[model samples]
Target chain A: MPKSEFSRRKFLGFAGTASGLVVIAGCNKDEVVSPGTLDGVDLGSGDIGILNYAYALEQLEAAFYTQVIMTQFSGISSPEATLLTDIRDHEVAHREFFKTALGDKAIQDLEVDFSSIDFSSRDSVLATAKAFEDLGVSAYNGAGRLIETADYLVLAGKIVSVEARHAALIRDLISPGSFADDTVINSDGLDGSRKPSEVLMIAQPYIKTVINGANLPTY
Target chain B: MNLSNIIDEIEKADGEAFDRVNSRRSVLRNFAGVTGKAALAALPVAFGSLFKKAYAGTRGVQDVFDVLNYALTLEYLEAEFYVQSLLAPGLLSGQLAMSIQTISKHETAHVNFLKAAITAAGGTPVDKPGFDFSGGKGSGDGPFKNAFSDLGLFLAVAQAFEDTGVRAYKGRAAELLGGEAVTTAALQIHSVEARHAAHIRYMRQQLGSGVGNLQPWITGNMSGIDSELVQPSYNGEENTMQASVEITGINGFEISAESASEAFDEPLTPEQVLAIVDGFIV
Candidate 1:
């Protein structure tokens, strides 16, 4: 209880180390290491990491929506046409939003090869759309904890909610009654979450930039 | 008992080791709350200012976890709704079952993804709890009938929930700012959610749920039949409904002022989201 002891502990607190009573833990570095190359994406350190991450997803969404609008599947009902066009516009806006937000920090426009997607057929288009949407939702959930500034976090949150909506819509389109079913929602009733490294790995094949995420920090 | 003499003695013995030991000891005392306030009071204005700054009081990572938990909660709600509706009697046709299954898998992935994230973040993944689609228990045909029967109501409610979710995620974006990987995944999910909202609106229109069920993003403010329900001359000669829906009959779509604008989602501070969330948590 001496003043010297009290001051010593306080000084240590100033150094930012955890309290002796505190438990310090981190993800098993080996467990979550991503397998694929980052493609060409460069998520700069700090906030830039987040911006690049968003940019990647926007690239995927823009491509998918563009295909939907361009092909205009045969037998597409009136509602289908209207909604798909609207989605196309939204994706365009999202792609541009990240571009503008990242400004000079933004990476080059991503190259997405959707030759893998069979746009001529509704089944093919919707299925791809569903995968992209679901991936988007899971990506955001996983990345939520990695943000630093509250303001950017808020921005990301707004953007991700929109993505979740996309996932729901795509689900319904593929199947009317499947908007928030077990396939998307887990037993915990929470959406999916993935770390950035994991997300980038999944996105690598679709993107061509060869992302170098080494500079990005993990929680 | 002279403080200066004791300090000199410690310094002469091994300044660096002494300093390190002293620093470690200080951290422990603060851990016990003996030095917290005084040390805080000694901080410079800028550092002190942080104390006054709004916290949204989310328990730092704990609250961030809460926000994630809430997100998971909503995700599950939507996932379950879809899963049940797909199989609900008289809801979806057997022909649509295959598509529903694919969507089902996606939702499943979503749930698992969040579970992993929460686990990664050192928090317990919330187990799925039984959700009440219907407002109450014991209502004869019960919840499914209520949620599934009226396609219009179903679509409308879904729209509202999705919109709210989009806003909610945005509201909590800041809390996740500390971590990069998590933030990136969140933004990806946010974009998907928006698309879902637009797609659902399309389905509502296809099924003739309601006239106003046009895509909100596409709709600025134009008049169609639904606009007639409102007072005539809602927006000068150019109907708001016209801006709202893109149709051949509407003379190609005229971009509304709202459509041309840079629309950012309104942020709900962490404190705000938590306050509301607490009401529902238990």
Candidate 2:
């Protein structure tokens, strides 16, 4: 607790380097490597690392949707409810799909912390949903190359497109004609593509699980 | 004429057939090898059904240069189409105008990016093909008669184009996998295409044509669109199967046919995509 001491662990925790922590621990590269959030879970190496990365996100999404349905936000319209339910089902299906596909390779279910999210507020929920969906698209796009098998690559595509659809729908609901706004799309006309380490970092706060993805394959 | 004879010939014949797999892939690979007069006498039917599936399969170890050039062609078509629309007088207004304007700029950027990518890869970029945009339904009497006047039809065509682009990128995704950086770039474009498709679908819904069940995601049940012109673009979209398993048939999980179909987007072959847009090119 001394003022002179730099809290590397605390800084990494706050920075959401949870998954990156695994890599530092596994690789003793002489240089000082910052660890991720304390007690972060391991995402397992290889395809399982990528799969766990996806499963972890799906779990967060499914939890969010379940909460949205449970505590109905005021002014929620029939169309909105119906649309959300469909999205909810789709997210659940996706979550279960990865869980089943990974099976023994799958990471344990993570504890999601949504205390900061105001479930009763429709705007808050939609904003969070939008972020999650957009991040999911980029995460998959970024992870596409890391996949060793053609079968898994195609499977990831199948899910990412739906996530993109959800992102577009949510963006329009928040503000019409804002689906592919400049925020996510770069000057190259390409959409956002975030690394697994980066995505997990952004998703750290929502997840309390310590995911060790240090052994994940890099292309 | 005989299936057994074809199988017998395949068993003994070899050379450039590629990796062998049972049933589907093997049938396609064998058909791939018999692509000339020398093999014609061995089989009569030519496995027409199997050929389509094989053609629709992955690029299977293609060079990066070929992938870039192929992608460049699609970008050129899209960028040009958007450029034409934005040039039309009073064609777009309000939110529709703004949305299409942003998309137009993005497509323009995509064209430039792909051209650069191809050039950097030491491949000659394909020449831009002149587009008719009217689907050749009539003479090039200005797009006013074709789609500009009516916002619904305009968005419908836009939806088709973006949807095709999404599938087009996906179909070739596997080939780019061998190159990490290029694969990331391709998927980035692919995701953007999906986002564009979703926005167009939303715009169509806003037009309030009472087009039931139109949404951002492809339900693959585009039978509601009722247009022969767009059918080729939407072909195979109705599939309720993924990873070779029927959507509803999965154990301990229940998904309505519609939800299952909506859950995943299928890839469209380049030929199928071209067939949809070729009529638009003069």
Candidate 3:
């Protein structure tokens, strides 16, 4: 259950008012921050902030899978279809969990633009899915420390591994055994995690609302 | 801020910390002064059925160095497993072989990363342990006579390693809070292992050996998995509740209790994981 009254607009307004906490950048258009109100979605500081950040990604994933299922990839194989559908359900469940957990403090439903994706083509669809899933995993890993609550961190761990599973499945479908390729994973066997700011930069094109994670804890 | 272990213990008990501070928190207080940051970084998840069961009484790593080394040892085991599999003359070919090759790289990368990190942090990296995949020690052949001869056994072993790895990292993930970067990096590695596990399951399903409908997770049926060397990896994976909340039948959507448990993977303590890993090591 949500702990407090944390409306999206209210949090954004509060972020602007709360000591210039968030630096909102990377919008589709060159929008300037208003005198007191934030121009885009401002993830609040601390645990709530991290939860909102994750919610945004889950929403994007759920939304993408919804479309993928709506128009199954042209001649999609049975196994692929089944796995994709399973992933969709998982994403929906993850999205709902964050929404309920954050309650009023949760951010508004993020507007996503999948216009660039060629849903009809399996290659196009799986590639974008790969990108989204990979981004989601790294974002969770990157943002783990910003979380103040241990339970929340565990919840994050729970969701992220699934995303990784999704990523690996998508990658294999595209190219068998390419799940943990050299691109995302570095040479050190250590998975490279980006900071929230770095991840949002890559995720911004698909997301309508800009996210301000400048105030998030980075220990 | 890298607070010492003493401060972490003292600070976790809030009131006691205050009392100690009033008394002689000077040593810890001075240590804090030296570090200039909070004694702890990412706090460990303290709730969940498994947390209450698996995490509460178990021992945590002494410091980030020990954490890195523990991880390093596992990576070594995994990396060597893949390397040996690839080296076998008649085990795999084509796509299956290609996949093994790619995974081998990732595991090797992890081993290299942890080794370098431990060395960079002024701690000695744990040396790679010699492995006997056949569950036999010093005999050059183990229980898995077909480790290189049979693909099914190979995948089973891979599943064991990857699944154990996923839970193992999760068990210690939060405890490595002293070094957030390492914990985060470990989390990243953890998911990749999950992906490998899923892929292996997928491969098994494709082979049509009665596990055709296998999902990416453990569904509580341990029928085909008879290897004792890998059985303990499934320890506590049957948990149905998360953070004390039942995962099934929420919001009128009837999700299977099995799927609910599968949705979120549980963690295995280092001791539990090592018990399984040690069986394969000479």
Candidate 4:
């Protein structure tokens, strides 16, 4: 399913070139431009912090899926292509939802480093999907309480369930009939969850912007 | 090159403009149990599925410590379930085996991490306990055989336990927010648990057990001809229902992800948990 001309490496080079061009063009702007505090880079002082955190992850997902679409993995079948595409659309919807929900408080567009990923291979892509899906689920679980508004929490629940779907699909892709096996489910047939601070640490390397999560209010 | 000049130049243009910016979002009250009474006294008073009794009368560090202990208790129960299920005859295959093994390891890791965090926080970890999923207190075979033959029962119990775990983490997240290291690890493990629940539900779908495995709180449909299994609020394939229950204290709080009424697993308070778990050992 992959196009021969558009390798993930090639895509990165293009994105980097585009960023470089932007930097050069912005030389005349006279903003303070401190080490931190970009416009819309939510410092996460309170409940918005958790929402910002989810927003950041969603940004990463949208970026990854955009790249996936740009260069489909080689040797992928039609059903896999269709499923992956659906997942991509869902992630995009989630990304936009968070951006809209957070409005001006949403974090800026994050720069992702997926150079370590070999997207040409199905195994590599699915493995990455598994990781992202798993991380997204944990992110929501960890940040759920920090959210003050019930509407926001419910929104998170909705988004996280979508992540859970991604996790199921990725698990099955890795091995059929393995969806919801004991590994994802404990013996009691339940799932696991993590907190936001922990989830951010795992997601940080892939994200470039500084997240001011330290000052966010907690219980 | 001049820092003060840079600060002044920007400050002059928008000193008052900063006031128009939104205030930092407020931290939420502990909607689950924010009555401000003794932590230990909040027991047995059920808030949906989590029994209020679990947290009564416990003091400052102890209250936080109990939160971890409660999480540990749930993990232990889940861990034990996997340990036994893995050993059960003729029950698993392919990706299922690997997934279960990995989950076992994850649970073990969670238990260890929580134990360490609790001790580091200067509170004693709650000892592990044997979880009895059997509804009937008198008959052992009824529960065991039912778990094996009626996969539906097994999934229902599984659903309750997983859903409880998901909410348990949500309830206790406030306590961990103070410690970054502990909070990060707890959240990671919590999400893993959510994935596990989804996976289990997917498996049930494959096996055609047709329990409302996907949405635990909202029941939609079961394969059998029983009204007990028919949840009204689920929006999945079986029912176009929506969740009607709501949680007080929190604005816009919907208790069930799905809008159906099926079998609901009651919440356990820390005190009720202690009482129920008095003699149990993991």
**Among all candidates shown, the one with the greatest TM-score:** 2
The candidate with the higher lDDT, 1 or 4, is 1
lDDT of 3 by residue, B46-114 (tens): 211111232224343235556666777788888998998999988889989888887888888778666
Q: After TM-score superposition, what is the CA distance of residue A8 in candidate 4 from its true location, in Å? A: 9.1
Q: Taking the tens digit of each residue's C-alpha lDDT, what string does model 4 give over A120-151?
A: 87776776777777667755655665665645
What is residue A73's positional error in candidate 3, in angstroms? 2.8
Per-prediction TM-score to the true structure, in the order listed: 0.54, 0.80, 0.77, 0.55
Which structure among the candidates has the greatest DockQ? 2
TM-score of chain A of 3: 0.82
lDDT of 2 by residue, B18-42 (tens): 3212233223222221112243345
Q: Return the candidate ranking by DockQ, descending.
A: 2, 3, 1, 4
Task: Compose the digit string of candidate 2's lDDT tens values, residues A103-136.
Answer: 7888788788775577777777777778788888
Estimate how well candidate 1 is docked, as a DockQ score.
Answer: 0.17
| Local accuracy of candidate 4 as per-residue lDDT tens digits, B1-282 | 122132233233222211111111100102211112243243432221121122333234444555666677778877776676667676555766676666666677667656544443334555564454453332343333455335455554555455446545644554544433334345555555655665665556556644433321223334221323222112122322213322111123222222212212122333433333222222
* Full candidate order by TM-score, most accurate first: 2, 3, 4, 1
DockQ of all candidate complexes: 0.17, 0.31, 0.28, 0.10
Candidate 1 residue-wise lDDT, A1-219, digit = tens:
433333223322332221221111222455543343333345677677777777768877887788778777778888678667656655666666667667788878767756455566777677767767666666656655565666566655645555565566666777765666655554423455555654555555455446566556554
Off by over 4 Å in 3: A1-37, B1-62, B137-142, B220-229
Query: Lowest lDDT 10-mer window, candidate 1 chain B?
Result: B231-240
Q: lDDT (0-100) at residue A81 of candidate 3?
A: 84
- Report fnat, model 2: 0.57
